[model samples]
Target: MSLVRLSIKGISYSQTQNGAYALILNEVDGERKLPIVIGAFEAQSIAIALEKEIRPPRPLTHDLFKTFADRFDIVVKQVIIHKLVDGVFYSSMICERDKIEEIIDARTSDAIALALRFDAPIFTYKNILDKAGIYLNMSSEDKSDSEESDDILSTPETFGNTSSDEEIKNTYAKYTLAELNDLMDQAVQDEDYEKAAKIRDEITKRES
Candidate 1:
């Protein structure tokens, strides 16, 4: 079966699902898109990586994994969105150590987060794409010709192709360092370490 490489295009808070976010993945070779519903923490993690934000003293789980991989010379080659079962998409990370490949089961959100951090491609089996893909209207004349270019065989371009960095910065800039610090404290009080890490990272980025 053929595979379709995808790159994240946009992430927005989903009002319908409280604390959930919509992750839009655009096809690398075509005009199709796939939108996945993911939790708030996962959204933050993906956003931080996409924006190249620096984390605080304590490493987040994904950060720790990246550090471990670097320390042991394990290269993350790609992250595969392998299947969708019972409304949940299954994913795996393809890592190479001494030329041996390893497949590790992971949540789609976590896999994507790590994939972005490691500069790895994200791919899905054709079957999975067939099940959940949504093709957007690309017929508008205003659409750039570059959008139709087939570059799936290479690294999927960064989120949103051109506007991701500016959007991320703007989105994050709304919160002051003190506000983010307070959010981090609240997250910790609630035992949401994942959210705390994200808030911490945002604060670090602003302060830096």
Candidate 2:
């Protein structure tokens, strides 16, 4: 299987699945996109990594991993989203330490997050992309913040894409950082990482 380079197109909340978010990846040389469903905590971690200006008061799990990897001289050379089974995407981190390289299994979300922090490239198998990739009617790069908040992406029949109206219409903008943190804790306790991610986005927006 040949590898295709990919870049983060955007992240959007899943209207069809509560607490699920879509991590959109675009092929660097093609219009095909791979949208992987991920948990809210992973979404928040990825978004935080992308937003170079927004620093969290504490390190997130991905951040901690990045710090530890850096300290030990384990550099992530690249991340590969290699498989899709039952709608779940599997990824591997291609890391090197002491002039030796190894591949480590990881959730697609976490792999991408660390890739961003390490400035490592991301890739996916061409066969996998051909299986799950779709050509959106609209460009992923053109999606606005409001559109992301709203749910407007579609994948053609070849790809299995969920469909539904946008859920959780409330904007967390009105909540203060402390309130958002409390809500984040509650969301975690309730295992509602999606809501926690939305709150995290709102907090990041305020800081930006």
What TM value does model 1 have? 0.66
Who wins the lDDT comparison?
2
**lDDT (0 to 1) per candidate:** 0.66, 0.69
Task: Point out the worst 10-residue segment of candidate 1 by lDDT.
Answer: 152-161
Q: What pairs collide in candidate 1?
A: none
Question: In candidate 2, what residue range of length 10 has the lowest lDDT sum?
Answer: 151-160
Task: Judge candidate 2 against the unseen true structure and give its global Cα lDDT, from 0 to 1.
Answer: 0.69
Q: Tell me the spans in candidate 1 whose CA falls farther than 4 Å from its real position.
A: 53-57, 141-208
Q: How much is 164 displaced in model 2, in angstroms?
A: 15
Residue-level lDDT tens digits of model 2 in 52-83: 88899999998898889889999999999887
Top-scoring candidate (TM-score) = 2
